[model samples]
Target: MINTLRANLANGIQTSSTRKFRSATRLLTFAAIAAFGLASTSSASAACNGGSTLKGRFGVLVSGGTKAGAGKYVDGTMTFDGACGVNGFVSVGENGTVNNFISVTGSYNTNADNTISLSLALPNGTETYDIGFSPIFGEAIGVETDGTAYATIDLKPQTAKVVSSAPVTTYNNATLKGTWAAACTAGSPGQVDLNYITIDGSTSNYGTFGNVTGVDHIYQAQFGIQPIAGQYAVLSDGTFGGSLTVAGAYPFGFTGSISSNGNELQYNVIYGTGVIEACIAKRVS
Candidate 1:
């Protein structure tokens, strides 16, 4: 179906009657696929299952973040070689100088994004990663080089050996669980409250929801109001609201939109006007 769609999309925008017929033919084909459900792959599902034998550790470059001790940090092995899964350990960097080991594991399935929401355990505690990667291989991942579409892990203790790692399960929305750092913007003092989605069903349509803390007027500390769940789509209402069953221990919510950028699940949530609070909560997933 994806291939058919791609072909139809690139067939050149048509206007002639003959072209229209072809366009209708392609559209009908896509519809037929949708009705019959041509989007199912068991191999992808099993890639990040509980136990499998295809496991391995990898080493990749670290980029992004501007803190003095932020760039070029490697502490744990990007480990995960299993039959029905894919995962890795993000090396320790500025925030990784304390925890002994920090890693994640889970299953993933997507063409544009190689991801799984594995469990992320650290010295401070354990959380899940909106874990993402490009090119699913043993140790040959991290091709984007900007650290944009990878697991957004918290800084942990530095260790030479990879202590742990696993594949994140997308079916469980592992992309919507984690600790996010948001500031107490200028005006929205109380505590910036936000909620959002992190999992990218694709590079396009997916959802992340949130609310933010109001700004602090006196101390000037950008404290935030975290949702018990990592994100929300309810918009303060209870309808489409998404909740993180694992964020109650924190204090700030998030500020991003559940979006799909015409490709796959990508969090396009930004700091919009009244649409969002002062400080924004974006899904780094």
Candidate 2:
């Protein structure tokens, strides 16, 4: 059952790009509002059951090194309303020069497998990105549909002091704190097997989750290019959660879910230059 789900998850990542054009069109409505400075009144809150996990304020970083001729990077903050609306500003950098802040807007689709599809409107064009959340839900990692750019997003509950005040209801951390074996696969290719243990109510034990074994370096690197090792903080509201960088070589974030019984944890880990790795961690003790 686990393998089947993992395979399906992998397939979803591969096919997510097919909807790029369609996604762009759907986001135009929000883009127009953002361009006109009407974002303050834009509402994405809807009374829907199974509340969305994408609601909150996110710090985003986009990086593409000469993939399209000139290296590009974007730093900005984006806000999502848990339904499908998003708005933000991006500081675009090209060839090591900071350009100007550009307003952006878009819509997103939350997939059944915990992946997210986003269509963001930039001044130049609309671009699509596929993001994956980690088991706890604090961070997201994504890449442009054309693979020309990549991004890492750090999210925090809009109401930090009162998580319950957020639009969505999340799981309790006491029910999900533990150690488990983890297996991860990237959208591109290859798989990684490792172990992860979460504790302190909101932090993870940092370790590697990539090609440490005698796996093929090329294939392993495709999915597990960097060592999947870092300390991650579980979001206050649960819902697979998010993370913050306390002290580390790279920033980390993730979102996902723990099975009702708390034995299974499924999530995506986002880190270093926009890489999203789907991970399943099963409690063994």
Candidate 3:
């Protein structure tokens, strides 16, 4: 986090301040697994151009890849040949249907469903595989075992709107135009007041400034020139920062967040000395 930013307004009295934030991109991906002798297509919500990929039949197809248990050709199907896996086995076809294997097999779509009906095919029935029944085990006796392997395939229509990990509700152009009392502070051990009135915004906002002369009359009971004034941006995380000006001189400003309720607006005022560092407020409504 940048913490805060400030720039002198050429003049001596006023200054501009900005709150800090971190802007970074985040993406997430995970894998799904299913044991032998099963169909492709997950039972979860995944978006794909219909079912276009095939799953298992663990083994060496008469003609697929040099890799073990890999599929071959575009036979509108592929099978799993149980090879080196936890519960290895095989599923054959574009629909990923197969029989024969071992333990552990479940599912998740290599591609799920679509809001529309979509498929990939040539103009003619120029694509289709013939059925074959050629099984080989040994000279006579037979022994078999199934295996397992996990795979993570990309869902079709890879574009997705990241759902916020948290819920965020919105409010209309509602106005907070009432007079109320509040108690506030500026630093670590700041003081609280007996009463103070709210000016603008609402229970959760930087609101508007204008208490007599815009100075936050935080203590309600104290009487003097206000220390800060200006527009503030309240963040969803309940923090705030912005600029403020005094009289007609160079605009002095602060950056901070709100606490307790709308009644308080604490900030870091950077002026001559290092800074006021922190401040606090409360609603006297």
Clashes of each: 82, 20, 58
CA error at residue 249 for candidate 3, angstroms: 4.0
- TM-score for each model: 0.23, 0.39, 0.27
Please identify model 3 stretches exceeding 4 Å from their true place. 1-198, 202-213, 216-223, 226-228, 259-265
- Model 2 Cα shift for residue 68 (angstroms): 2.8
Top candidate when judged by lDDT against the true structure: 2
Candidate 3 clash figure, as a count: 58
lDDT of each: 0.29, 0.46, 0.25
Query: Any idea how many clashes model 2 has?
Result: 20
Residue 248 in model 2: shift from native, Å?
28
lDDT of 3 by residue, 11-129 (tens): 33332232211100000000011211224332322343222232223211211211233321111112221221112222121112222111232221221221222121222112222
Model 2 lDDT per residue over 59-87, tens place: 45554443544444454456676777877
Candidate 2 wrong stretches, greater than 4 Å: 1-51, 95-98, 135-137, 150-285
Q: Deviation in angstroms for 148 in model 1?
A: 14
Model number with the top TM-score: 2
lDDT at 27, model 2: 28
